[model samples]
Target: MNTITANQLKTRGVSIIQDNLLKDQELVITVRGKEKFVVMDMKHYNYLRECELDAALHQAKADYQSENYITETVDAHIKRIKQ
Candidate 1:
């Protein structure tokens, strides 16, 4: 991870960010002495999103395997929600 001030980003523009991202670097942007933002390449961002989805799916599978879920039909679910 690399840290850059908000002012530096404003001065250098998004091109500097693109250059760093080519090396698989992530940026942490700070403003007013506090961490404010993150910059990452789209490929890495998509990979992370996929990882999160996979994790959720795995947890759901585990829960189902352990009989830890409730079973309901769509109509029943809608009726309950309408109440």
Candidate 2:
């Protein structure tokens, strides 16, 4: 992983990120000697979000196949959750 200090970012700005991202898919931003934030290209970020959704969908399908869910009326569902 590539890392950049907050001071470097404050002094150099987005161009440093742009240049680093050409070599790495992501960059870690550190603040006050602690890892604080991550920076990535929007396309990469969207791709990762899609992957997360896909994993969730796969888990839901597996749960359904295993009969791990319930079927109930909306009122019953709300009442059960309220309890």
The TM-score values for the models, in the order shown, are: 0.80, 0.89
Q: Write the per-residue lDDT of candidate 1 for residues 1-83, one digit (tens) a residue.
A: 77778898899999778776776558888998799999997788999999999999999999999999877999998998899
Runs in model 2 lying further than 4 Å from the true structure: 79-83
Worst window of 10 by summed lDDT in candidate 1: 16-25
TM for candidate 1 is: 0.80
Query: Against the true structure, whose TM-score is highest?
Result: 2
